[model samples]
Target: MTDPQNWAAPGANQPGAPYPPQGTPPPGAPQNPGYQNPGYQQPGSPYPGGQYPGAQYPGAQYPGAPGGPGTPPGPGAVAPKPGVIPLRPLGVGEILDGAIAYIRANPVATLGLAAIVVTITQLVEVPLGIFALGQLAGLTAAPGDPADPTAIAGVLVGSVAGSAVGALVSFVAITVLSGMLIAVLSQAVLGHKMSIGAAWAAVRSRIPGLVGLTLLIALLLVLVAGVGVVPLVVLAVMQANAAVVVLVGVLFVLLSWAVALFLGVSWALAAPAYVLEGVGVTAAMRRSFQLVRKQWWRVFGISLLGGIIAVIIGAILSLPFSFAADPMSDPIAGVSIVGLLITSVGTIVATTVTAPFSAGITGLLYFDQRIRREGLDIELARTAQQG
Candidate 1:
């Protein structure tokens, strides 16, 4: 009879070895003891098996199970990308592409979202104009003699009171509408349809912060105007652009343009940051400043692209209206009540269509930053699982 040790064993390194000697297992011998015969052991070796913790048993996989630790199912299958905006960090053009994709993916929702914002803005503008008109009327209707201090006081009081009341009323309405509109558009762009009430529910709690920031921004603009406009106008009257060019020339235009662009881009991202981050005005401004500081080119490119589109659409939409308003006035015709109403309506329609596309693009850009810097996708996954 053949020797027991010399009997051919499955997975043995040598054809005739039933088991390898002490401190050695055959090169292809079973790695786990239980899977091999129970008596399988090497003398003086306390540990019989070398399997690691959490390691799966051989030939024990359920049919169609995802094989191996941390491996997703199927050949060539990749795990899903986490987070709502799953696109990779985007450059300016890619962000615009994402925006266009959003519009294409949800045309009706995008339109509705944009409409809501545009309607509120345009409607508020109308009432604001009416209020301004009333203030102007009150100013004109003053009965007090110009020479009397008492009369001047009365006129000043009426003007001030009207101005304050008008501003307060208009601002409150716009603020409430803006918050509600943002919440709706945010969800809408994500392909979720929310009722007006639901959208309001999401944003009304943050209304005060939004309003305060709006007021602060308005104040900032007012301050900037006081510093820049009066001096610029005075200089312009004192010397024309060509004369200034002769003196400071191209430098003046360059400085003015640079300042304008810096301010414009700074303010551009501020509102979105406020709405999305729920940050206070100052914090939002700082955040925006930090984001755009090193990304000047990206910001400028996106802004230019959006601005060009807006200008082209504006020209197309306004041409007929401009002609309809009588194009031959020497001083140029004042705002026509009817024409203004029609134009405002058109603007609202256009805005409703475009706003979500822009908002989604902006929101996605914010997501990309957080994802790259904070492992935001992991947090988002946890949030989704919890939900």
Candidate 2:
């Protein structure tokens, strides 16, 4: 924090700096860090749930020193420690550690908000689950001895419709909450703090775009799956030759998978972009792609690692609750309301903890990417100084 007046945003005078600057680094910023924080923490998938929501999210807050980024910490030289993380490009351990630190640093905004959202999401799921399962169990054969196709179809349709509605509800609720959390992290990184109401207010206008971004990524994935499976399904229905079927299936699978992976990794930061950059869904996607395209593997690896940790931690934390719910949660035996409610409680406890951590890791990853690729530390420092 010494001699603040002379320090200039790195590359400020360079012809190609992202922004023009006349002064040195801001007073006390990590520089910039913290990305989107996916609010969901589901199972069987790494992202949104397993993605950043459940799978992975980015990192978090705290502040740094007032002086410039201090001699630009050389390789592992320990950059300015104004916040939860170092200002320079982050390492694998730093990213993970920062996530945990952030939760502790901003419990009310991070943990408190997460608990509220997960509680609501779980409570909502209980009724929807019972209704859907009940519809399936209620179907009986028509007047005829044989089962009625129409009745069966009706039940299936109803179940799908119900599930879709529930998903939409949970998605919107968690996505908004996650966005609010990111807003919290954005300030926290600058050594700032925010209340739950303040966090909500910061992100209120971006709700629509956040929801849209989630849906578009989902739609793209579904389309990729269809491309890989539709023809295989058709061949099976037609009783096509086994050899030809296998070959086509393998080729299609590989092609679709490649495309999906490219897009998925490239757009890993889209949620963060939407929240932080105030961009549309498509624009956010492009922003993430540009940010991630160069270090695709690194981004993918960090996200993968974050998702893995969240799953392991969530499983450990949730087990006791799951065991408690086991007696009442046996749906195969019957839709026991007690069991369903108990199960929901377990989910709430587990996700409440893991969701923010997941989001924080990915959000931090986003900050790391920007710092490395765009020298965002300078901009973040400036922002901090102004604030």
Clashing pairs in 1: 114-352, 115-352, 245-249
Which digits, one per residue and each the tens of the lDDT, describe model 2 over residues 190-300?
A: 666678887776677777878888888988987986698877888989999999889998888888988898888898888876777656678778878878977999998
Q: Which regions of candidate 2 deviate over 4 angstroms? A: 1-77, 133-154, 233-239, 329-335, 385-387
lDDT of 2: 0.67
- Residue 179 of model 1, lDDT score: 54
Q: Number of the top candidate by TM-score?
A: 2
lDDT of 1: 0.49
Instruction: Quote the positional error of residue 70 for candidate 1 in Å.
Output: 7.6
Q: In model 1, where is the ten-residue run with the lowest total lDDT?
A: 14-23
Q: After superposition, how far is residue 322 of candidate 1 from its true place, in Å?
A: 4.6
